[model samples]
Target: MIRSYRLLSLLVLALFALEPLQAQLMNKGTIKFEVTDVQTNNPDMQQMIGSMKGMAQTLQFDGAQQQMTVDMMGGLMRINTFWTGANSTVETYMDMMGQKIKTIMSNEDVEKMRKESEAMIKSEDIKYDKSVTKKILGKDCYKAYYETDANGQKFSMEMYVTEDIKVPNSFLQNLNQIELKGTPLMWIMDAGMMKMTFMATDISKDLGSDFFKKPEGAYQEMSMEQLKQMGMGGQIGF
Candidate 1:
């Protein structure tokens, strides 16, 4: 009886040890990332990059609702989009110059953006180096290498991603155009004079429904065309 009791206790401890691992592999949660660095070739852009340093962004996934939200710029800008079913509204909220602005993109607008992005991805040389793996934010991630040539400017990129925590692949299209088996945990992009890196700082299951809802208050609404003319359409992930 003593030996049986000891074996039972060990079994319980082993199961408890696997609990966190199971949670980490679960497909539902919110992941927080920080912009550790940003580099650019344009001197003017470099000056603006300082405001983005140490900036934090949160990507929340609601498996039940099949929706996701990317909150960046210290919550001053948020892009909300859906992954499953038909959601005609892709909403973004931005706080600019003490004014709250809400930008709405229709399903047609999002589809157009997707095609343009797909073309851009096709133009790049992207590959995965699975042999390289690192533990980032306590989760294992693999490396991906790629190069981008935009407007006659070429740059190289290295990204770390993990397949353990699953989320809709479409959710990452705005930041990354390549098709990946995992979610990016860290990235280092080099464009001669410009460089930028994003690192995941936290991953948790504490996401709430409220995180996906629009902010409470008056907001000036703008259509996709107006935002594009203002050179701000991309800010909303369009």
Candidate 2:
């Protein structure tokens, strides 16, 4: 009887050990941001900050599927991201404003981008070691500096990450209509600004597959230059 009891206890312990792993597998969350211009404070400039539907922006992560979807400008940017121990892969896509562009990269691609961006850093070397003080969402934030060299020009980059907020299921919760505070992923280039910020409203997780599908019917496929001539270049993916 003691041996049987020990076996049962072992089974229970095994189940307990697997619980955390299971939770990690199912971990998912959504992050939303309210976009505003720190310099101009003009609400209209906020629209030009990046592609977003009004002032609302959102990003959703599904840990189990290793996928994330960023919703902006009434369009979905799906990214297939997988992290293994320390390595990762991210595939980005945009289907909005009558345009579609997909970029897929593995850990190697990340390293390549890092190397290419080294020249843009203020240090002259590939190393980045500068931090800026800022306030986000009423909380203090440390903004890291980086640089990217594109088209023979160097551009400064700033990013912010926080450790204060922790939610078990951020995606499943109601996030919309909440004034969240956080610095978003932003990249400003010569052509325009590229940013990813959270929305102030929570959307139903029941987003249909069609939300990511491209629109049918006849549509004009214009080159970037052509779109610029037609004054629709910025409206499409930038």
Candidate 3:
């Protein structure tokens, strides 16, 4: 379960790691994606989770406001993260057992995490192959390939990038680490026996302002460490 959680987190990060280039070419729009397929190498996990399809995530970028929101939903897990250039806040809601729990990471917490991650950053080689071209969601894209080792585990990635649209490079370090270029319209990640693909289904310009705001209500807020403990304890329950 812990491994699965980590894989899912990586998947989300890969799907939204866009960096800014020229400001004039920046496109402000919302991209909706669906998890088209999922499979793992572990037979035990295969028996437990079966197929992971129909999971949905949305990425909204407002170039004028310099803000973005990512909302990912799968079964009983819902994660909403808001990014404002340099800082971010994450609100994760989980339905574990019969209890509904929520975890919030304020901007200060996210800044601390950023510092810690920077201190641990290491150099890794990434190779890109742009031999294939395809049209995804009406946009022309070229396929690029790369591989990396994260936390001693190796993973390979196939990404479809386009030169037509440019996005802000808020997470420039992450993009440089992965060695990705252009805009990624679709991404497929393979780690061990686990494989998942996220493809954009639609792009629209009118994402309402309310979509990025934090919800107003009661939720049992917890720290990042507590959330990790719950996640490891199988309290994710998804």
Candidate 4:
């Protein structure tokens, strides 16, 4: 009886310890963000890219999987991108007008795409300064500065990332080949033609059960090459 009681007490204590760890885990949640500003160096494109401001983007993650959603045209068009760290695969689904298209990228495909993007970046090194910190959504975020060289033209950019929220990888960073750590809360990029800024607005742990559900209805799945061949290469985010 005494041995069993001791074992039960240890088990209870272990459970109590796990509660704190679980509370600290911000893995399963959504970080809501809005495109605060879009500046264009070109006077002609100012009216065009300016419309991009006030757009919404959400980052949802659970375990090793993260999904990003971009809503445009008041939901007339939507882009859903999923990254599975377990297999290093990326899947993108686009719903625009009446078209339902999807693209699945394997680990090799993602690596190839990342390499192509990394080539545009002159250096693979990133400078993350922990001393420069700020709070976003009440979470502390550190500063990271990096530059990219595209066709001999260089553009400087920086990101604010917080370790308080854990994610397998940052999707925007993956796409642009920015090697910043933790979850990015603020991203300021200068694309030469335009300067776009994205900042997190809300953080929530209430993703609910339908968070992982894929879009309903038929989706024509195609490879990356097929998508490019369709004259939609630059339109979609790989």
Candidate 5:
């Protein structure tokens, strides 16, 4: 009887461990969003457009936990973003002008970015306002208004989340068709007076540790102004 009880307990524990692993395997896939410039007037704005052809991205999620790693690039810009959870932490590394800059952020940075995006969407202060629900690309979304104090800039923004569509391989697939609900993985805003959209794409289940590795070439870091003078600052705009 003792041996039988011990075996039963072990089986239960194994099953418990397998549950999360199964969920992760089921959720493992790729997502992609296309980034495009819809508004173009200022030369600086035109130069910052993600891609007339649209940008592509890939992300991987670990089902056992609310963690994900994203790989994205547009033209000369590249970035790797990691998120532990919705309100936990986010880290990003941006490659610009042959140099990489890393940003380790807390929930505060995420909230700040959220507020700024909300302001751009509403052309007003979003701090005290509640977000409204809407539909984008056939997926339910939440939206809010926001405005910028810098140069008195104004923008319209929209955010979306979805969970319906599932793919087998997220790294190679395009995310334009995935049906998801209540996922805060998309952001649309105006940068330098240009309307731009960022879509999550090419999600993966197995992201190697090296996916976040820095480049191998030797690089000379430069300040924003110096990079601009060298015509390499545009890489930082996306």
Candidate 6:
């Protein structure tokens, strides 16, 4: 009987040990990422970046749909993006300089925009390497690289992504028209003169349906075409 009790105790402890690991793989949670590093040679830009350091991005996902919020220019510009795989639609709400603008696009619209924005970039431009691997929050991650030319300027980025966080493939339009197999816990962006590293700082499961609600209030509705007409195409994302 004592031996049986010992075995049962060990079993209980083992199950307890696996609980957190199981939670990590569950496709529901909020990942808070912070701008951990900034590389720039401009003194004025450094001061600007210093203030932007307080800026952080939050991504909330629950397998079916996802919402990402990004703050730019020390919160002078805020972009909130919501995508639902069920309806295959994306809604972007931008709050900047006292102007509230909202835009909704269907999957077809997104693909069309993807084509125009990706005239110089294509899916083949992204490369993934399994040999390059690391650990973020105890999950396996691999390296991937993407490069493209923005008009005449060159853009490049590297990501350390993991398959542990399962999100819908339709939600993959954010990474420059390329589909990444997993969520990126760490990524480095190289934009010629400035470089920035975004790292996931915390993950929490304290989310609900209410968290994904559309923005309320007097947000002026705008179509994707009108947004581009204003030359603020880069201010929002799907």
Off by more than 4 A, model 2 = 1-28, 38-56, 61-68, 76-87, 122-161, 165-238
Q: Give Cα distance to truth, residue 235, candidate 4, Å.
A: 7.2
On TM-score, the candidate that comes out on top is 4
Q: What is the C-alpha RMSD of each candidate to the true structure, in Å?
A: 15.3, 18.2, 5.1, 15.4, 16.9, 15.3
For candidate 1, give the lDDT of residue 19: 7
The sequence of per-residue lDDT tens digits that candidate 1 reaches over residues 1-238 is: 3222222222111110000111236577788777787767687555456655775666666544334444444554444443332453456554443455565656666567657667666523558788999999778888878776779877676878787786543343233344555667887757577676878888897877666566668888877677557654443334
TM-score of candidate 5 versus the correct structure, residues matched by position: 0.46
Give the whole-model CA lDDT for all candidates, comma-separated: 0.56, 0.33, 0.55, 0.64, 0.39, 0.63
Tens-digit lDDT track of model 2 for 1-238: 3222222222111110000011222134454444443232456545344333243334444432223344433533222222222354434343444345443446665455345433333233222222665455443445544445658644443444233432222121111111223323331212233333332334223333333233344444433355346443233211
By summed lDDT, the worst window of 10 consecutive residues in model 4 runs over: 13-22
State each candidate's clash count: 3, 15, 5, 0, 34, 0
lDDT, model 6, position 153? 75
The local lDDT score (0 to 100) that residue 148 gets in candidate 1 is 68
Q: Report residue 110 deviation for candidate 3 (angstroms).
A: 3.8
Instruction: Name the TM-score of candidate 6.
Output: 0.76
- Model 4 vs. true fold: TM: 0.79
What TM-score, computed on C-alpha atoms, does each candidate reach?
0.74, 0.39, 0.70, 0.79, 0.46, 0.76
TM-score rank order:
4, 6, 1, 3, 5, 2
What digit string (tens of lDDT, one per residue) describes model 3 on residues 109-171? 655655554443422343445678889877778876766676887767777877766554432
Candidate 2 backbone clash number: 15
* lDDT-better candidate, 3 vs 6: 6
Writing each residue's lDDT as its tens digit, candidate 4 over 46-96 gives 555644677677878777677777775577556777777778776777776
Once model 3 is optimally superposed onto the true structure by TM-score, how far is the C-alpha of residue 140 displaced, in angstroms?
Answer: 2.2
Better of 1 and 5 by TM-score: 1
The residue pairs in collision within model 3 are: 19-168, 19-169, 20-168, 20-169, 41-193
In model 5, the runs with Cα more than 4 Å from the true position are: 1-28, 50-53, 64-75, 106-152, 163-181, 184-187, 199-238
**lDDT, candidate 2, residue 126?**
20
